[model samples]
Target: SDQRTAWLPAFLAYYNARRPHSALGYQPPASRIPGNNLLQLNS
Candidate 1:
């Protein structure tokens, strides 16, 4: 049960920061967020 607790944050991060959505022209929401470390994400 404890392991499942981690999924929400992971999923949100992926959904908002990694996985691109067609609505945003296939760009991740994070790209629109100013000052995020893009290099760290690439790694």
Candidate 2:
């Protein structure tokens, strides 16, 4: 359980920062954040 807890943050980071969502036009949730570099790179 400790190992799972340790990796959970990494997994959540990837999910919220990298995983694309169809509802978001295939962009990661992080891209919607103000001044996120990811939006500039994608554009």
Name the candidate that leads on TM-score.
2
Q: Kindly list the per-residue Cα lDDT of model 1 for residues 1-43, writing each as its tens digit.
A: 7778868899888999899899999999987756756666566
Residue 36 displacement in candidate 2 (angstroms): 7.0
Quality of model 2 by C-alpha lDDT: 0.88
Q: TM-score of model 2 relative to the true fold?
A: 0.68
lDDT of 1 at 43: 64
Clashes of 2: 0
- Model 1 residue runs over 4 Å out of place are 1-4, 36-43
Q: What's the TM for model 1?
A: 0.63
Error of 2 at 1 (Å): 1.8
Task: List candidate 2 segments past 4 Å from native.
Answer: 36-43
For model 1, how big is the CA root-mean-square deviation?
Answer: 6.6
TM-score of every candidate: 0.63, 0.68
